[model samples]
Target: MIDDAPGKGRPTRSRKEAEAARKEQMKRPTGRREQMRRERERRNKLRDKQLAALDGRGDAAYLPARDRGPVRALVRDYIDRRRSVAEYMLPILVVILVLSFIPNPTAVTVVFFLWSVTILSTVVDEIFLVIGLKRELKRRFEPGETKGAVTYGVLRSTQLRRTRRPRPTIERGEPLRDRY
Candidate 1:
């Protein structure tokens, strides 16, 4: 005899019927097209998530390995807060390249001179950046806690500001906070 109380909504399933339903629900899709569709959807979602993370609009956990961690965050902020000559190197180099194609000797000399000056300025800017960053690191973190931070900062500084991944969170000349 089945128990049908006043408040009960529906009858319970028999054991065999419940098991069959569970098995059917758990079964993988058997068709090739269904499998491909599911796989494609998953890949598209992952791609969107990664792109969002790279643009700094998504979770920090989804950021690339190199961009993760508090130390790296500090490094990114440090580099972003200052202006560097390296940021101009790419555009300047392109101009110099175009200038090199000219047949005139004067153009060649001018391109060579610009190249030397740009290279020198970039080296000087990066040197100061490294030294200042090292001092800040020593003040804020234990030795070795900031391993690879200088290189990371240098690399980040070289990119055009607009093209930097995980776009700069702070504007130029923004003062850093005391805590990370």
Candidate 2:
């Protein structure tokens, strides 16, 4: 007959025995699910390292804005609109000049109204460019001192550009263009 003791269904495992079993299972060769779990853990560790590296420097710290599909579309739209204005500027100015020669008062007023709208669009585009630059600069700079000495060193050497010094104008004491 099976034992009917309060602590027994089969033999109850002690805490140490249960822990040892867990360790043994962990040490055993794992299948696909375990491999995936380990891969995920490795990816997380790499992401943490990258984030730590980005936190301290003026330039190295900023991750470029991700190209989310909608955001990319918006950026392309802005660029196209800006380019359209640039391409049309001379033609529009010529039209305005010709319109000024029209003697009718109503035609002059209409030309003036169109010119005002063009000016307003140009101003709005300039404001957007300024705001974008400010945002980009802010993203590139660190908020506070970065962690990890090795990260700081690598970023300084590889990624960060010094503001105070001019870039080298020569390669091997020859003109940079000549070196190529």
Candidate 3:
């Protein structure tokens, strides 16, 4: 004789009891969990959209391929040019020091101050520029290549100098040197 219970001879929950169980489960913290899940899903969707936008290409399209020979050569050339400045900086510093000790100490001091300020600012500007340029060079050049480092350093410095923020006020025809 086979027992013909709906749950294959096992006890089965009544409809009212099952409905109450489902209601209790529904009344639990499932809403908060669902809310968290939805938030994560939304965030993932936004991230995907942003990634798609970035991949759509404007400036990224203009960036040279990392393996481009010409790009590597250009970086090498820049590095070579920047390295040459080290030789000149020493002589320039010595000359400035000598001039600062001359009879017209006021003029010498002013000149020295101006020169030092310019050099210091230039160095600071170069650091930021180099960071950006190195990123670009790494993007363009193959790994382990140092050729672009110097060139990137110098050009970055020069570019930074050119793009530096202008002082708010300048008297009529007064040079930036005078303001400093």
Candidate 4:
């Protein structure tokens, strides 16, 4: 019972009709609203994927321009692998504020001293971080590629590790790879 013709048992379309159908299938949405809807969907998908990657659930290809490349990666790892005085500044400031509220001259003096020391340590720590990071950047990458890297790393170090963007790839005190 061989009932097959060319395209199963259905009547065949002319060549022009088949070509038109294929073109229609491949055509982009004709209306502006439909086009915008499709574009929005694509952007949403990209954004979600990027966020997932930043959270360590997806590939790193979707990382934003600021966080991409080996230079930035090295900077982040360098900052994340060690403790910085800046990391404690926020909590210390909070404590200092609480202590400042006491109705005592001693408390005020202690708060002032604590504030000065904290700020001084943070600045010194940042300077050291910048110097070390610059040295590493020079060893690993060209000078041109490392523009703003010191500042970027310093800013990242200033934040509490738990609150850092891109979420600290390596644990504290972990060793960095020889090459990024």
Candidate 5:
């Protein structure tokens, strides 16, 4: 007799029956198509999470290695606090673009001159920022602590605060406290 009471062993199907059911299940689209759909859904979710990580919107644990760690966070804060020529570049470019639509040759010449100056100034600022950032990082961190930080700082410096991914956490002109 089968034991149907609590803690009793569950029922089992015969080998032939189990094999037949398995074969039937495999014949349906719910087999391969369902698996592929699940896989695609998983990938889409993972892609969204990764994008959020890139945007600096999620927990620090999910951040990319290039952007992770306290020292890198401090470097980002420092660059964001300072006013950068590169930061103004986007706005100036937009203005120049609008000016380009005017019919006057003088406007075109002015736009060219403005673009040249902005580019030159931004290039010079980026150079100084990289040097200073590297030196400061060296002073504050061990040799091993600063891998890829120079590149990180240079890229961060060029991005405008408003448009930067993983939006700026620290306020503009705010002095960085010794958080390291």
Candidate 6:
């Protein structure tokens, strides 16, 4: 077979030989244990990096795109500096819950109204906050810089401050500088 010339009225390989060659290409498992170990290692590495970033201990390179920019940093600072009514929302909700159980209809009505007002005011406040943030960002940054940031800030503000991930780098009531 090795001495056979290329396709000169004689096929280089028989059909059985070709079929055996094709069958030789099928792969067996490298072993399930090895594959599982490698996959576990990959997941552990990814999870470590992700948790580091979420814990605010990751370096700039590991930080997510949404949290990397100077503008977003400034937005974080601005939101962190001021105390938002929304930040107090959990406590307010507790109060409302307690008030709702009062036997008096008047008490329930009052609590309901209070909750409505709180929700309304929170909406208005968040709207204005986003609007002002947008205007300032437009003035300070080129367009597309602030995209998705308004919603980011708004959602961040609504989260109870203590529970915020990528935890606050600035102290509450910190004076903001015009560094942006």
TM-scores across all candidates?
A: 0.78, 0.31, 0.32, 0.81, 0.64, 0.70
Q: Candidates ranked by TM-score, best first? A: 4, 1, 6, 5, 3, 2
Off by over 4 Å in 1: 1-25, 103-105
Winning model by lDDT:
1
Distance (Å) between predicted and true CA of 97, model 3?
3.6
lDDT measured at residue 68 in model 6 versus the true structure, 0 to 100 = 75
lDDT of each: 0.91, 0.46, 0.51, 0.89, 0.82, 0.81
Of 1 and 5, the candidate ahead on TM-score is: 1
Q: Which pairs clash in model 2? A: none
Ranking by lDDT: 1, 4, 5, 6, 3, 2
Preferred candidate (TM-score higher): 2 or 3: 3
Positional deviation of residue 164's Cα in model 4 after best superposition, in angstroms? 1.1
RMSD values, in order shown: 7.6, 20.4, 19.2, 9.2, 9.0, 9.5
Highest TM-score: which candidate? Answer: 4
Q: What number of backbone clashes does candidate 5 have, counting pairs of residues 3 or more apart or in separate chains?
A: 1
Candidate 4 accuracy as TM-score: 0.81
Looking at model 1, report the run of 10 residues with the lowest lDDT sum: 1-10
Tell me the tens digit of each residue's lDDT in model 1 across 88-165. 999999999999999999999999999999999999999999999989888999887899999999999999999999
Give candidate 6's TM-score: 0.70
The residue-level lDDT of candidate 4 at 67 comes to 90
What TM-score, to 2 decimals, does candidate 3 have?
Answer: 0.32
Local lDDT at 174 for model 5: 90
Number of backbone collisions per candidate, in order? 0, 0, 4, 0, 1, 0
lDDT of 4 by residue, 13-73 (tens): 9999999999999999989999999999999999999998788677778888899888888
Candidate 1's error at 34, in angstroms? 2.1
Segments of candidate 5 deviating more than 4 angstroms: 1-58
